[model samples]
Target: MQLLIMRHGEAGWHSLDQERMLTETGRHQVAECAAQIAASPWRPVQIWSSPYIRARQTAAIVSEILNCPVEEKIFITPEDDPGLCLDALLENQHSPLMLVSHMPLVGSLATLLVDGHRRGIPFMTAQAVVLDMPVVGPGCADLKTQFLP
Candidate 1:
């Protein structure tokens, strides 16, 4: 299964907890990333996004191009726990999955998947990481691939 992890585009910090929206640049970033995803050899079967407006908007753009439904997961909550999201990924073994989320979570998730521990990795706006999970020996796994926008 291929896991595509994406961080939402540039979101303006207008107010705390006010559900910040994406900037014009952010929208363009989304468009660019969406085009890349469409042109890439890999494709996701489904998209999972954070409930945050920025994340949802980015996912919506990609979903429009991919023609797939977006599945909102609470694990991508405002106060996110990367491990929980990883657990969610593990629980859903469906292949070619895409997750649209925030900075720390996206970076943390990638770091965890690759290094098996929390390592801070800054994600560019609209950037994504693609990881291939190899099923072997009753649940042991490792990071396979990582990509960016």
Candidate 2:
């Protein structure tokens, strides 16, 4: 299975917190990122995102381009632990799964997947981290790819 972790594009602080909308730059970033993914060999079977407006909007663009359903979850939020979210995502991993989330959480998950520790980090906006899981076995998953937007 391939897990793709993505972070929402640049957002206005006030709008992100209040209006919950993406900035013009953010919209363009999402579009470009979606285009890149569409042109790539990596295609997601399922797309998951945070309920936050910026994340939802970004996921919508990717979903449209990838032709995949996007589900919203609170596990990707700032208030949630990224490890739990990672575990939830692993449990549901079916191959080529995409997760759109925030900065620190995304970074922490990537760090944990690649480094075996969170270490309090941050993933850049529109970054995608891919993990490979064994087709069958006890330790089924391992980090495979990490892409930056």
Candidate 3:
């Protein structure tokens, strides 16, 4: 199985963090990253996005580029628990899946799968990483590649 993790594009500030929308630069960044994935062998067949506006927008851009579909998942929000997120993810190990989420969550989830801990590595906006695993679980994955904008 393969998993792709991505951070949302750059977002404009909003009083409600969830309401923040992507900036033009953010859109371009996502486009660049999406194009990189489209040309790669690891393009996702399905994308799961945080319900936050910026994440959904980022997923939309990648969805368009890869012609993949998106599903909004509430457990992937920035403040959501990574353990819960991992539990939810376990039920969907059917194909190449991409997750579009926020800073801490994206980093934490990636590291949780790849390194067996939540000591996350940094991920810039619109950045993406690919992980290959025989199964979807902690410490089961190997980092395959990363896309940077």
Candidate 4:
């Protein structure tokens, strides 16, 4: 199975984090990354996104481009635990899964899967990392490719 971890595009400031929406540049950035994925064999079969507005927006763009369905996951929020997110991801049998989330969660989840640690690696806005894992678990995945917008 392939796991694609992506950070949401740039978002404008809002009083509430949940209500923060993507900026015009953010949409274009997400579209660029989505197009890159569509051109590659790493196109996800399904996209799992955080319920956050920016993440959902990012997922929507990828969903349209890749023609894949999107599912909102609560565990994928910015401050949510990566371990719990991993468990939830395991519950689904979908291969080539794409996750659209926020900074800390996205970065931490990628490191957890690839290096077995929660130490986050920074991701630029709308950056994506692809991992190839036979079975989803800590330190079980190999870095495959990346997409940036």
Q: Model 4, which residues run further than 4 Å from truth?
A: none
Candidate 3 structure, TM-score to reference = 0.97
lDDT of 3: 0.92
Candidate 2 per-residue lDDT over residues 1-149, each given as its tens digit: 67788888878777436247777888888788777777777789889889888889889988988899999887897556867876686578456888898877787776666566777456677767676755422244576666665
Q: Please rank every candidate by TM-score, starting with the best.
A: 4, 3, 1, 2
Task: Please list all clashing residue pairs in model 2, or write none if there are none.
Answer: 134-140
lDDT of candidate 4 over 51-147, digit per residue (tens): 9999999999999999999999888999999999888868879889999999899889999999999999999999999999988899898999999
Task: Give the runs in model 2 whose Cα sits over 4 Å from its true position.
Answer: 16-19, 135-143
TM-score result, candidate 2:
0.85
Query: Which of candidates 1 and 3 reaches a greater lDDT?
Result: 3
Error of 3 at 146 (Å): 0.2
Top TM-score: which candidate number?
A: 4
lDDT tens digits, residues 107-143, model 1? 7777777667766588898887777667411123355
Best by lDDT: 4
Worst 10 residues of 2 by lDDT: 132-141
lDDT of 2 at 7: 86
